[model samples]
Target: MEKQFVLMDVDRNVYEVDRVLNAQTTNIRSFGSEWSIRLQRLHGGLSDGVDVVWVDNGCTRLAILPTRGMGIWKANVAGVPLEWHSPVQRPVHPTFVDQSRRGGIGWLDGFNELICRCGLGWHGAPGTDVTRDADGNVVSEQFLPLHGRIANLPAHSVTVEISDDGAISIVGVVDEAGMFGGHLRLTAQLTTYVGSNTFEIRDTVQNLSAGSAEAEMLYHCNIGRPFVGEGAKLHIAAAEVAPRDSRAAEGISDWPTYTGPVQGYAEQVYFVRPLTADDGRALAVLAAPEGDRAVAVRFDTSTLPWFAQWKNTQAEADGYVTGLEPCSSFPNLRSFERQQNRVVQLDPMGSVTFEFAVTVVSAADDVSRLVQEVADLQQAERMTVHDQPNPEWSP
Candidate 1:
């Protein structure tokens, strides 16, 4: 039987304990491995009032934040940390974040999670978003903030599930709606198994409005040392790769490779069309310098057709990290993405789901196996590397 715990239900007016854990009182625990689940709220600084849920499956531990759109704050798989050091040092509360600050790029103030969703309504660079009627008369015009409001919105309801066979799931529901804006609900679930070095995220975004609504999402999966250092590499099967701008074009020849932290290295982003398996599953890996440890993200091209690789190898204090992003559209201005025909339009009460799995391998043998698999997929087709940004894919 699958045991369930209701953490929060707005409609039911239920708000459980401030903290919960698996103990003798509950009489339910995973048998072999040391498994546990805890829910707590932060009390100080920027993290104040943030609701955090922790799940430890013996081999893997995940910290999830329902206050941050059910995003995974961080993860540790088989003793390998899957997170980066961001200048924003805490799990910031949404109240402290002004999405419109700093010229629409203020989303960086709360972007420290290892895996953060970038959309519910729209996820891209901030700009004036205008919608016009069939005859070109403007219907709506407004400035959209950076990355949308999903990342900073709190979940209205959350539930924790434990299966008799030792599977753990944390599900949360967050709605992005307002007066002029339509309603978009995000149902996110994070699942893992006891003693396993893997976890999966399943997110479903639904349009709860009477009229059609625009939708876009990007999974920004970030990592740092020891998975991103000198000699480390990003292993992915890409049929084509292009720089996002001229700055990124400078390093196009060595796009997939990495170097240790530099004092003044600027960030570079590459847009890619990844080669996928027959099943539409695409993979991206960040290997450590020693090649014995690695973290991999498995996604589907059928749901997420675009990929963005962000490399920011600046000094540690400046937030040295890299991002392996999978998205429905490129992270450009919403207007540009719409011009490129990359946004999703959801009908009334319609929904679409996105799913991905993360795995960590510490054994050299296992890492080598994944490396070889990525290489094989890469070689299946001749890759086209654009020296400069592709006008078709970038603004």
Candidate 2:
């Protein structure tokens, strides 16, 4: 392993490369919100890379490798990059195209810009356009910028801290009322290492604005293909699934009705049973194919009670793996009544938090025991229902 990746010391305001890169990466360094982290790739069998930090700033948010149209040939946190072989596709480069627009709707906290390279549809009805190079490979040109006006401009407060082991912790507040009043806040802490195949991400959000401001967020993980293909099986303990009633994109809800005995992959959101392993922890599972591996998400019950599952129906998109999101909120908030079938409310000055653990394994068969442990933790906890209700998404 080469020192291919770098880390920033917030206290000293500098970046450091811990290991050397071999067949994986080249000289790459980018800055985001005062943190300058080095990027690296893994050589040998699996496909992998290390990226850091997430902020709303254009440069900061768009600095990661998967940005624009650059594709990750094989990248995985578990050290197992899904193999792409067959009469079909082979691993490729990042594919990113810019659709200059105002106000990013589907951007999902600018997180989507990190990898998907497509802007959210919000600024103008929310849509995406992809541009491919002559070889038919996706390539990115410039950063896709998304900005909005804040009602009560809170104090701009931000913090970044990294552990000895490379776990990065961040505190950011989109302050309202002079940074003292309740505001939109985001908290994330993550650690990734090429030597250690596991990468952990934890996030939280708070609302401080006046009145009932609808909030939208997504755990947008842009996956790569062939590895994330039809061979993959999405295993979640969630009891129900929801979908946007009307969207050009592919999802479960496009099927017309989400009531009773749903089968096959449809663009939909899932409502999981109040999950708790025997130790009282929330657990969710995602399993890939046999030669491939799977990912699992587990969290405590109080902080995050909701789980959402999103997958791209289009094979042409970045990758084929489903997004296993355990969040306090979802991107389609306004449609909660009709699609999600539930509402999560944040009273004035009130906040919510979610904590979970993620582990990657060699096989998908481990999902059953993992789910059973989650079920053994306890009974169903009642969730808050918003305005309208859809039986399919009702928890």
Candidate 3:
């Protein structure tokens, strides 16, 4: 027998090699060894029975609570905390109360990372109004809760996805509706990418009813501790800054600076109209005292045309926090806002979208760059006095 020179299958051998090479290349490009998502359920503490999705992308870690209206429970960049936690230690589930018992400072007990999503009919205070019930019977003292119910309501149909490019996204839908009230739905998506120190929030508020609905939205992004104590500074590209009240006006000259916790410092609030860049976006930053660390927010001003700075540097026991809020309108009562023509109205089947991103600046060069940007904005226009004529109230 001739030395069995088995005829070499050239085409078959080439195809096998090509397939293996292609697979290896794809895996190398798509696999993120350091990024992962973990879903966990809490058993004790305020988080008991709460389901959280933790996303870690090597550079940043975020804990998203689906049971808490998809609000972020905690976030950190490179082991540095980025959010403020209230004195109230427990995470209260929305099921604990209905609209009657909810609203007001009572909602602040579990405030962590962020809260105070005001919307629908009312926002700032617990207002009592008379309205017709479904049966056409008049009901008096119908209460509209503080900050609305979106923050406390749980998200339905929550989904988390990880893309081949190592981006993680969490999406959910929250509904705040009643039998004879405005029907509103908030569809939210939170996204971050591997090895990146930034995270983005994209939300769409839709009026699901057949009639026009009044809505307000505010993102109370809070900062505390090392990022908000004495020596820390706030930078905003704002065209105007109006003190919300006489108290805020008292310290209007020092609005950009922060001080150590005062024994009884009344919180100061400033209403800001940010200056839009050529791209129609606005930037704000809160820097550490040393200026080595900073948290910056970039948002589209077309949708969120208003900004509020909340300074609550009272003694620690009383709570020390700073809030950078981007909103559709001032945090006034819905009735008051409507009178000012400041409230946003969504037409039947209409929707509004808001986009914002938060990023940590840790590098010295990046921090310097941010400081320069703030300086440029400060020189462009002096802070505007909050004296816009309003029939509802005067500051």
Candidate number that wins on TM-score, 2 or 3: 3
Top candidate, metric TM-score = 1
My TM-score estimates for the predictions, one after another, are: 0.97, 0.51, 0.84
**Candidate 2 Cα outliers beyond 4 Å, as residue runs:** 1-75, 82-182, 191-196, 207-216, 222-227, 241-274, 278-280, 317-321, 329-331, 335-350, 363-395
Q: Which wins on lDDT, candidate 2 or candidate 3?
A: 3
Q: List the global CA lDDT of all models.
A: 0.89, 0.37, 0.72
Query: Cα lDDT of model 2 overall?
Result: 0.37
Q: Write the per-residue lDDT of candidate 3 for residues 1-395, one digit (tens) a residue.
A: 10111111233341111121111333324344466555566677666767666777778988777677778877888888876757765556666535555445555555665533555445665665444467967654455656777777776556555566666677777787888876899888888887889999988999999999877888888888768878999888777777788788788888888999899899998888887766777889888888888888888988888888899999887778999988888876665665576777889989989888998987668877987886786676765555432334321
In order, what is each prediction's RMSD in angstroms?
Answer: 1.4, 13.3, 10.8
Q: What are the per-residue Cα lDDT tens digits for candidate 2 across 24-109?
A: 23332222222233333333321222232332111112122221122122334333443322221322111221223344432222
Name model 3 segments beyond 4 Å from true.
Answer: 1-33, 97-103, 128-142, 377-382, 386-395
Ranking by lDDT: 1, 3, 2
